[model samples]
Target: MRPKVFVSQPIPEPALDMLREVAEVTVFPRLDRNMSEDEWIMAAQRADYLFVMGGNIITTNVIKANPKLKGIAMVHRRLPVNNSIDLDTAKALGVPVVFQYPWEPVYDRIAEATCDLTIAMILDLAYRLIDADRYTRSGRTLQEHTMALMGPGVTGKIAGLLGLGKVALKMVPRLRALRMSVLYTKRTRLAPAQERELGVEWADQSDILRRSDFVCLEYDYNPSTHKMIGEREFALMKPTAYFINTARGRIVDEPALVRALQNRTIAGAGLDVFWHEPPGSPEMAPSEEFFKMDNVILAPHNGGATWDARTELTKATARQIVTLIGGGRPEGLVLD
Candidate 1:
């Protein structure tokens, strides 16, 4: 008998077909949202492998309900937190949970999205693109507009990256093409050869803040990094500098960011994630203040929401599922 796989959320058709070849696939009927707690527990009880996505809460109750379950495959691009899946429960149950890796196929798509958002934020702040669009739509022309909205250009500016990870590494060439010098700060410094190849200068967080025309946060979120950027760090930035964050929101203090924007301490901001993300509601943003601010660009925590990225992530998850089912330990095993 083929192993049964319960998918708690909808994935691409190609990945579904891939899993169908090796397992009896049972997908949650709803494609627009995740399954409820009861539904999730019921599904877990029925399947040998639970394939989950973001927003599905896999608690200890679900794990204990299914003693015959083999493992779980999570299709998230970032590190899975306890809210998504209770790793302690899975560890206690001796069920391995596999997560997606940054070196996998979906990293490029995420990197591209991050870079795109960073540029969009810069252009919007520098030129007031959103305001200009509103003016044009309201039957106004350049002749009627004054020089009040004129802002700085991006060429020959300094761009700072908080982390030199995969996303930040991909952003280097793009920043260089704009004739911008890139400064990066990481826990461990890169080799001289690598720095030369990527055309990035190593700097501490304070130096990056003081020198950069644009400060981009690309670091991972953890206990050490939580609230790393607060009022003091924001105060270090040049008044004309723009801040961009495509990584986790908890890395920066949201209230402090709101205060900075309100006071114009920093020029503007572009944010993709938030500290308190309402479950299954992608339309929600950080706060009402961000919605009213013209200097800010807000996304629904979906920087990597491109179709290509989704397909690639689904494929990667399918590969991991197949490997686990075939008695092979795949990469990104959360328990081990």
Candidate 2:
């Protein structure tokens, strides 16, 4: 008999088909949307392999119940803390966990690209080039503007990355080419050699806020990091700075950000994630917050949802699960 696998969330059709071929796929139809805590554990108990996406909680009790379960496969690009499978508990249960973050490195590339794009927008470079296209017709002179940046993470690294990991590693040379000075701050200390290797230097966080022409939030969201940028942090920024947040939104207090944008604390903000997913009522499914304000750019968290990108990730995740169940160590395992 084929091994039984429980799918705790909806995945792309291709991935689901692949799983069906390898295992007797038992999908809880209700779970195709989101699974409740009780339902999550029930699903866990029935399957030999579990395929998890964002919402399900794989607690210790579930692990203990699923004596036959061998491993877990988490398919995602960014494995936020809230969504991470409890690694310590999984280890205690002796169930190996595999992570398929095929787009992990791609996030840095997007960050770097967006950073460059934001800077160009701030400098009016792209605007000017467009203007130049109709220069003869419009008779308007091209202009450049200055910007101040805030925060030092993936987006901040676009101005120049501080090299937190491999994703940050790729942004250094591009930043130099654009004549953008990379200023950043980190919670940890690094030797001069390490700094030179990544081609970035440490600066006070506030200093970046005060001096950057464009500000980017690139840090993760956690209790310690919640509202790392509040009224005080926004107050430190130059009024001309165009704040950008492709990072988690909770990092900045939403009310404070709205106030800043309304009062013109910084020129404007571009946000990819918000404090609340689905923003308001669940009845308004597939909801977004574009009606809230003009200065803010509220995207539906599609920063990396390109078809080729997500499909590749789905396939990679399915393959990883198959590999681990076959007793081979696939790349990107979350549990050490």
Candidate 3:
């Protein structure tokens, strides 16, 4: 009999087809909502293998109940710990848990796509393109010397980066090409030579918020960084400056951010993530206040939603699952 494989969340159809060739596959029905704990437990009782994704927590309880599980495969660029997978329990039970390489093509594709979205957000805010589009679409015509759509120019402006991770590194050239000076802040300061080569100046968090024309959050979110951008941080920014976030939503205090936008603490904002937007959760409801504001721009966490990126991620993850199912170790992947 073919082994039964349960996918905890929706993935690209192509990956599903690949798994179907070797196993009887079951995918959680809700594409816009997260898989419930009850569903996960019930599936574990019957599935011979499990495929996990996103911020789903594969707890010790889930693993302990699924003794028949041959292997569990996960897809992510970060450490499995970030996903809350119980590595120790899985190891104790001798159920190999697999993840793609940190430098795998799946992550490269996501980083590139996210970089594209980040630049697009910057451009849209710098030129107020979306606001202009809305006015035009609402049956308003452009008039002579009305000055209704004038926005801060991108050239010669300062762009502050909150994190200097892979995506932020990729964004350096794009910002430079627009003639914008770059400033970055992270836990570890880059070497002076690397700074000179990248044309970025190191700055403290406070300085970045105070001096930058565009403050972009590209950092990771952990307990220490939770709600890092708050009322005081917004107050430090120039009243004419803009805020952009492509990072996790919890990184910024949602209420504080909303208050800032309403009070005009900052000139405008471009946001692609929001509070309560966990992985594989399509039912995340964004703030209605953002929709009412003309100065704010929003996306549905679509930075890494490009077809190429998603396809590569699912395909790579599928390959890992296929190998483990066949009792063969996957190349360029970590199995524990």
**TM per candidate:** 0.80, 0.62, 0.84
lDDT of each: 0.82, 0.62, 0.85
Which candidate gets the maximum TM-score versus the true structure? 3
Estimate candidate 1's RMSD in Å: 3.9
Better of 1 and 3 by TM-score: 3
lDDT of 3 at 216: 92
> Candidate 2 lDDT (Cα, whole model)?
0.62
Please give the TM-score that candidate 2 achieves against the real structure: 0.62
| Candidate 3: C-alpha RMSD after superposition | 3.3
Candidate 1 per-residue lDDT, tens place, 198-243, comes to 8989999999999999999989888899999999999999999999
Task: Compose the digit string of candidate 3's lDDT tens values, residues 35-137.
Answer: 6666778888899888887756677778887888888777765453344577888889988887765445677789899998998988998888887787778
* Cα error of candidate 2 at position 162, Å: 8.1
The better candidate by lDDT, 1 or 3, is 3
lDDT, model 1? 0.82
Assess candidate 3 and give its TM-score to the true structure.
0.84
Best by lDDT: 3
Residue-pair clashes per candidate: 0, 11, 0
lDDT of 2 by residue, 168-213 (tens): 3444465556556666676775688987875666777787787775
